[model samples]
Target chain A: MEEIQFWIGIVATMAFAVTGVLAIADRGVDIFGVLVLGLITAIGGGTIRDIILEIPPFWSENQIYVWLALAASVATFFAESFFTQPQIYRWMLYIDGFGAALFAIQGATKAWMMGFGLPVGPVILGVITAIGGGLIRDVLAGRKTLIMSHELYAIPVTLGCSVYVLILNFTPQYAIEGSAFCMLGIFAIRAAAIHWDLHVPKMFITKTR
Target chain B: MEEIQFWIGIVATMAFAVTGVLAIADRGVDIFGVLVLGLITAIGGGTIRDIILEIPPFWSENQIYVWLALAASVATFFAESFFTQPQIYRWMLYIDGFGAALFAIQGATKAWMMGFGLPVGPVILGVITAIGGGLIRDVLAGRKTLIMSHELYAIPVTLGCSVYVLILNFTPQYAIEGSAFCMLGIFAIRAAAIHWDLHVPKMFITKTR
Candidate 1:
């Protein structure tokens, strides 16, 4: 399971970097901008989580992630045609979803253990951990993030994180098992959403009057 | 000077919040989203800085800034026309510029004192402190931020911050006077950009060949 998690993380980082490269591919952003966006997307979420918890940025602890993102971005820059493949794009989504789920759970667990903002804070931090990097990426590239697309992007992660937090609150010893369970569950829901084109029902969505 | 700093911080918070509210005003985003953006823009930069420095967020130290941002966002939500007025918009630019300059100086000084990444890290942090929140705000709202607009937005803050850091490196005693000088310098450049439509020269622009 640990090895699996590591591979998922690697896939997530490269996937995110590729998407980041693609996000600004046509924007005429220079090479520097492309790399900056890629690195930000790959590590931005965990960075926010660590910062919110008053810890050194996760990347600073182990610079491997930074180097990987840079490598992926540079590769994407040179081989845009290869990365733009439809098969690679689809596989990357599942990889991205898996990473987001684990990231959300990890973030929630950290916040809960740290005892920061209790009750609602851990869940928020978890969601931020899952989606924050993508949000930063989209914003920098002026693209519409899945978060703002009124889709199922944020919901599954939020729900999964909430359940994970609740499990920890009630049964702390179940953290490991709960994390695995929630990770799969979130990924399943995300995959379903993508396959079925699911969205938040009208009642749950806030409409501007 | 202390009292002046206090007032400037307050104005800065309010100014950022108002702009936040305005950024998504026409996007059909709900009131909650507006307030969230407002609060994020008001404190996001310092939060990033603190996180990078491995400290509690500055807003977490003093909740007043959060309250001020909330108030400004609420006020803007109700009085959209008032905020959207041309005169108010014009005045807000200068106020925002002033706030950004001060924020950059403070950020640079903090990083320098803490001895983070030396020689260059503080300048980056200072620029991030000044422009980070606005970048988040624009990204959230899917608007073209001043940073990406090619108008003289980040350059002044970066240059001013570099100067301030240099002063701290050599003449630490001149910190106060140097800060004041840089503040005016940044604001002056920003004002000139606004008035005369200054831009980064074409030679500096990256072309996608």
Candidate 2:
């Protein structure tokens, strides 16, 4: 399970890094800029979480994630021109959703291990950690983030966190099992919503303004 | 002195916000994007600091800073083209230097008050707080920050932090007075470096193979 979590983290990092690289395909940014975006997409969340938790930044502690981001960025930089299709945005969304889910679970688990002691703060911080990388990617790419979208984007992670926290409290022996289930649940929900364009109802669409 | 600090903070916020707006001009970002960048540049450092200290975020308690950043961003957005001269960069450097110095002093003082008697951590965090916003701005803008430049940018703040910490230990009563002097010292050094294009000696310049 620990090995699975570690591999999932690496995959998530690479996915987000590729998303960042794809976002700036035509921006004429140099290699340095591309790497910066990729690194931000990969490590920005964990860095924020570690700093907020008053720990040494995660990337500085383990250089593997940073190297993975760099390698993925270099690969994407060369492969960007091959993405001739106009569905680039869709690809980005797919990759981003995958990364966010993996990160949300990993982050929550780490926060729990750190003795955050509550469902509320850990859940909130987990969501922040999950979305933070992509948020930074969007900010740097000069695009709107998924958070600002009309879709029920942040909901799945919130639900996953609630369930995980509840199970952790109620069944300590199955905490890891519950967390795994929650992680997959979130990934499925988020990916399906993105794929189907599923959105929460608009409170303003029915209004005659 | 307190009044001066207050005005300095306000002006610093305005300066940082304007810098963000200026960075956004080339990208043709909307009102929301511009405002976000401005607010990030204005309060991003302090946010990081508070989080690192495990304290509630400062801007949450006082919404005035948010309003100020919003107002400045809006004003800069509308009046952007008018300030697109090359000299704007020069002005930004000076304003940023002032802001960095003031924040460095304030952050160091706060850390001292929080009883982190060791000079190393507080002083380093002081410099981090001072330069963090600008670093974030550069990262979001896809531009290299002044820190990566050959100039003596962050070094001045480091020096200022050292002096402030020294004063805190040696002459506790004069700590406040010493902080003011250090602030001016940093501002003067940074302003001179910017004006004169002065930089720290590059010992590694010859090692570029």
Candidate 3:
């Protein structure tokens, strides 16, 4: 389980780096700025999660994460045309969904291990972990926050986290399976939302231009 | 020394809380959002600093910080028109400068005590602590980050932190005096910038729309 999660984190780091590059696609941020943005977006969520959990920042313990994100960001910068393609943007959306799902589960697992218990804290942590990086990227880019947008971004992650908490609370035996089930469910929901042009319902949205 | 620092922190909390309300002013965010933003803007910086230093969050030790911020935010909400005055915005800017100065010093003190050494890590931590909350507040509110603008914000904090670190390294006996001196210097620089419309100069600026 530990080994699998480690690899998931590695992949998530790079996926997030690419998304960071995409976030600043046309604003004329220089190369140095692009690299900094990449590193920040990639490691930001995990760093925040670790800090909240009172653990050493994950990148500080292992430099590989930093190097990988830097390298991925540089690669994206060089391959600007590939990223600009419409199909590639759609592809990144799926990769983003995958990373968000995995991150939410990882955050919940850590919070649970640390005895945060059910429902509120762990679920919120999960959602924060999942969306925190993207939020920072958009914020730094001066774009609207994901929560403020009409997109179905936070909802899937929230539902998946709640389901995981339910599993941990009621049926401890299926907890391992529950992790996998939740990750896939979150991803599927996100993919469906993107495919269907779905949005959060009107009641939840604030009226903003 | 610790006693004085604690009071500075309390004042900073209320100051940042008011700035947060001003950030969302005229945006039509409801009462709950205002309260939450206030609490977040108040504690977010110190919380980040503590987490990075691997210490328990400051608010976790004392709930008074939380209550004070909430109360200040509620007061601001009730007195919305008073806050809308041009002079009130200017006053908040000075309060922001004062709070930023103190928080930067506090962050540097913590990092130095933890043996982060000269000129690099501690300085970065200090700046992060001073600006982290405003960054979040502005980002969530979709405003440009302080660092991105030409405002002389981080520069003063950075110079003050450098002075603090230098005092710590060279003349350890005057460390407390150095703290006061640096805080005042930072606030003075920021105030001067606000009063004179000072900027970071065109050479250092990136061409962004």
lDDT of 3: 0.81
DockQ of each: 0.17, 0.06, 0.18
Clashes of each: 0, 0, 0
Using TM-score as the yardstick, the better of models 1 and 2 is 1
lDDT of 3 by residue, B1-209 (tens): 67877897888889889888777867887889889888888888778777788778878999999999999899889998887789987888888789999889988888888865344557757887888877777776766766455578888888899888888889999998998999999999999998998977654433344
Sort order, DockQ high to low: 3, 1, 2
Candidate 2 residue-wise lDDT, A1-209, digit = tens: 67877887787788888877776667788899899998897889878877766688888878999999999898888888654354865766776786787788778877778766354446746776886776777876776664434455567877788788788778989987887799888878888897888875543111111
Per-candidate TM-scores read: 0.62, 0.57, 0.61
Give Cα distance to truth, residue A1, candidate 2, Å. 30
TM-score of chain A of each: 0.91, 0.87, 0.93
Better of 1 and 3 by DockQ: 3
Chain B TM-scores, listed for every candidate in order, come to: 0.94, 0.89, 0.92
Clashes of 1: 0
Output the lDDT of residue B36, model 3: 84
User: lDDT of candidate 1?
Assistant: 0.81
* Share of the reference A-B contacts seen in candidate 1: 0.24
Q: Who wins the TM-score comparison?
A: 1
lDDT of each: 0.81, 0.76, 0.81
